[model samples]
Target chain A: MGKRVGIEVSIAIADAVKLARADVIAAYPITPQTHIVEHLSEIVANGELDAEFITVESEHAAMSCCCGSSAAGARTYTATSSQGLALMSEILYHPGPMRLPIVMTVANRALAAPISIWNDHQDIMAQRDIGWIQTFAENGQEAVDLTLHAFRVAEDRKVSLPMIVNIDGFTLSHVIEPIVIPDQEEVDAYLPAFKPRVRLDVKKPVTMGPVGIPEVYTEAKMAHNEAIKASKRVILQGWKEFAEIFGREYNPVETYRSEDAEVLLVTMGSISETAMSAVDAMRDKGASVGLVRIRLWRPFPGPEFRKAAGKASVLAVIDRCLPPGAVCGPVGAELRSLFYKMPGAPKIFSFVAGLGGRDVTVERFEEIVDKARAYAKKRPTELYEVIGVREI
Target chain B: MAQIDAIVGWKDLPFGCHVYEPGSTAKFRTGDWRSQRPVLDKEKCIKCGMCWVFCPDMCYSQTEEGYFEANMEYCKGCGICAHECPKDAITMVPEED
Candidate 1:
């Protein structure tokens, strides 16, 4: 173990990135995500980290370079935010299905069209179906811890899926916090050198990036799906190992005060901390409210949710991004489907709030509980509702 | 089933053969082979040597008449020499196989 340091979460994440010792990094600069790569660039330039950092023109090229590096059997890392992430949308689907575990950091930001550069869930929401294992950090400490664990989990043999460790744009990315910095030897021992089962090598000729016909395309997709679905165990195992060394625990979905609560709020990314504070305040007032923070979003913790939602009365689902024309937000839709097998499950209500970095206060969360309670009285549960926005 | 040279209808299509078999060697066959064919305009032949110098793959050679000719065997159909010709001497045209 090395000395502890007081640093910003973004810097701490950069330090962890150094410890991982990636062979290649292809990235473009975007706000909030800039500090992470900037620090990494300094490390590489100052000779602290030995790696090839290719500064590409756009996010598309950044992802394209990562695809090339991973195909060449090198451990790769890249960081981007908001628009940069959107630019790489085309190549996002290739890595996971191809089973190349390139780790990435997505400083969560709102999507454009009044063109806001602030934090929100819109960027990641757009890529929900891209097949990457998604995870969110509640604060800077989790941000650093998750960044290191993400590489281990993604590279696990069962889950060769690319991972996106999302921290809030500005909130967690820019905030400084105390963190334990492990020595390089400790990290090397923890994360062994990655040996890709299949890589592009001239010594052994292999065909890659080939176009597949419809006859075998579905099978390839199914294999990718099964690999990610099986990755849950690998993810837990990696966390267990990390816990042994650092004493930090992780799960797909982490529950806070949900053991005896009547109402539960489910969310992802940095909003969980805000939601947790609200839960604590509400609990003090004798309101039986709790939170289900989804740290892993891609292979969503379905079985765990079924266990956590055991007997809660009303489940208030919150989403930062709107899935237009759908009954509820994305997380809400996924959670509702998990309880379809139960005969008597709690009534579920959806809320779309905190978009474009808008403030989601404790009062707003309490109001959502009230709405869920009211909606439960009526037998027919309307699927989703936008929380703060009012109709004219 | 009877073997046929060419199919005029769906009835002659092969059945039960998987297209994505491990050793499937099916290649895209086209009748109009020359999706791009280089043409030389004799009137505009200045022979500046720009096209030959700019070709990354050196697929062009000089004809006895001092004009450039494209070697189809080595040309990967990049169209760079034709597009970069200073005299507009090279033109691409489609040809039938």
Candidate 2:
């Protein structure tokens, strides 16, 4: 059993990492992600956690340092958001193919040309294809649990791939909530010490990240693709172990009140909580609406999503990042393509909302559900609809 | 191509980006890229070791008698050693096909 205490989500995540007994933490301060590394630094400095906290010059350097440490057989972690994630983008691709189990926290925030430091999914969404196992946390507890889960899954020998846990920027990162702080014994029982399959050592040297010439480049990429897709088993195993120890169940795709509903609102990150309330309210008034929150984003969890969403007659996928000039937002576009050929798949209506720190309220979700229901009936040819757009 | 096939056939080579053995590139003979090769004039050589320090490919190795010679197996024949040799004891010559 674990003790429940009220703590800021970022602080809880830092504590979770400390409990996980990370060997190295390298990060640069970025809005919304600053508090996480700051807390971790204090934890290391105070001797509560015996770890190396590297204050890197930039997010690029932070990820580079993480790569070096993780390659040297250390359990490594880092946190970044928005431009920091974009800055680290160059090195992000290296960890996946190098097969280093680096755990990172992306306090999801909107990207910038104008530059606003508020909450959105744009930061993490832009990094979808980087080969990291991405998991979205709906709230503070999920933030802590998923952070620990990420380390467990990443370090699994079968997986040995990097992972990112996305917590919606100020919305979740800055919020204080009651969360279970698992006992060190329970955590130790759940997560074993990282045993690296390959590492950089002076005594037994090995090359990592070698240039793949034309002859083997395609084969290398194909192997990487297979590794990530195959990691789904290890991911589920991690979750199963976590549930056994903590008694808190988690799934790749979680649902609320969707068993018999004909209409479904699909969401990721913090907005799913708001969507849940909207579903409750609509159900009270005799509306057949439900909520599907995608927890695992990478390796896509396609089969789980198909099973969860197959029964619904109409599905409204609310995307937080606008995939500019595309027919739909990123999540919407993915869902559309996923279901395009599947027999008995629901009609997926794409909706873009809550971008750039905009609040997605229950009423807005209600409106989105109504719009999706209407669109299902009319069957419009448009790619997707941008919700809450101001009419001139 | 045969050498590449042999290296690629190594058990650990198939595991994507992993390098199972250290210094595996030593087996990859980059000397094949050479259009020009460096020849050492043992009689004129002063054994200053400047060529050893200046070779871009680190292909220059010391003989048992302390004279430096280019290990043509891995040398790309960049001529850096010949260019930097103070005694003009090393010369760059075109390789015969």
Candidate 3:
């Protein structure tokens, strides 16, 4: 057991990486994600952590370096946000099929055209199909816990995939919160030393990332797809082991007051906490409303999500990112596709609420619920509704 | 056809972007794609090793008597060896196919 200390979430994440005993860290500085790698550099410089801290010139190079390090059988890590993540996109798709279990932290931030450094899901949402296992943390504590869990799941022999833990940019990354910083011994017990099933070694050389001609390309992709899907079991196992050791339970799709509710608000990332507060307020007003937070995004946990939201009559899916020109926002569109063929599926109302760090207050959530109820009562209309946009 | 059949099933292929054997490109036999081949004139050879250095595929190797010869197993007959040979000991000729 370790003492509960109040620290910034970025520092807590750096501490988690240190506890996990990552062997290599290659990162480029970017807003909101800078503090995490800065603290990690300090730890490495102070000799508290024995790791190779590479200060790369760009996010592209940082991810490339991480790929090289992880392929060389070193437990590797990196952190980025917004444009840094976008810049790394070129090399981001390499680690998954290469089966390098490198863990990264993504401080979710808004993409720039007008250039705002703030919290949003647009950054991570744009990278949804890169073949990495993705998870969202609603608060600072989960950010710390999931950082540790990301390594455990990624390094599992069955999973052998890369993973990203997304924490909302200024909201969760810069905020101070009380978190339990687990001791090294407990973390060592929970996450064993990473033993790569295959690696680049001089004594036993093996070719990795070889060109896949057309004959084998589809098979290669199929193998990568099946690996990520099968990783759901390993993820659950890691969370189960984490609960036994830390006494904090986690699920792929976690529900709040959704056991008996007619209207459900679905959210990911830090907005889930605010949505939960809104759920409490609505419950006080004798409204059967609840919250469903998607903690795991990749390999989507479709069965778990279906079971959790199946009983609801009306589902309001609040998307933080605006998928322009699409029928609905990204998360909402995904949910619609998932529930379209489902038996007795709830009437899903897609709402794009927060974009570019726009505040999604409890009042906004209440309004979302009201609009969903209204749409459910009326005839079926548009596929999605963009809320909070001022008429200009 | 047997080789193609072996890889048609998912179980036969290596999992997840792997090349199970190191240096397995040797088995590809790129010489089959060659249209022009470099013939070495051993009588006029000075063995400056320029052909070996300039070979795009590095297919030229030193012989026991210190003369350069193409391995032909992986050479694509690019003719860089013939073009770059300082001693004029190599000439590119059309292959019989």
> For candidate 2, what is the DockQ-based docking class?
acceptable
Candidate 1 lDDT score at position A323: 73
Q: Which of 2 and 3 is the better model by lDDT?
A: 3
Question: What is the Å distance of residue A156 in model 3 from its true position?
Answer: 1.1
Residue lDDT tens for model 3, A116-170: 7988888888898999999999999999999999999999989999999999998
Q: What is the Cα root-mean-square deviation between model 3 and the actual structure?
A: 3.8
Q: In model 2, how large is the Cα lDDT of residue A61?
A: 100
10 residues in a row with least lDDT, candidate 1 chain A: A208-217
lDDT of each: 0.80, 0.90, 0.91
Decide which is better by lDDT, 1 or 3: 3
Candidate 2 lDDT at A285 equals 98
User: Could you give candidate 2's per-residue lDDT for residues B10-96 as a string of tens digits?
Assistant: 224545377776666676766778889888899889999999998878888899999998887888888888888888988889998
> Which scores higher on DockQ, 2 or 3?
3
Q: All candidates: CA RMSD in angstroms?
A: 8.2, 3.4, 3.8
DockQ of each: 0.04, 0.34, 0.39
TM-score of predicted model 1? 0.80
Candidate 1 regions exceeding 4 Å error are A379-382, A390-392, B1-97
Which residue runs does candidate 2 get wrong by more than 4 Å? B1-3, B7-16, B29-55, B58-97
Per-model i-RMS in Å? 12.0, 3.5, 2.8
Cα lDDT of model 1 by residue, A1-392, tens digit: 66677898888888999999988989899997999999999989999998999999999999999988987888899999988999999999889878789999999999888898788888999888999988899988788888889888877766677999999998889988787887788788778787776777777756655554444455566667777788889888988998877777888788999987899988887778878888989899998998888888878878887787768888999998887787778888887888776787877888889988888888888888777777888754457877788677
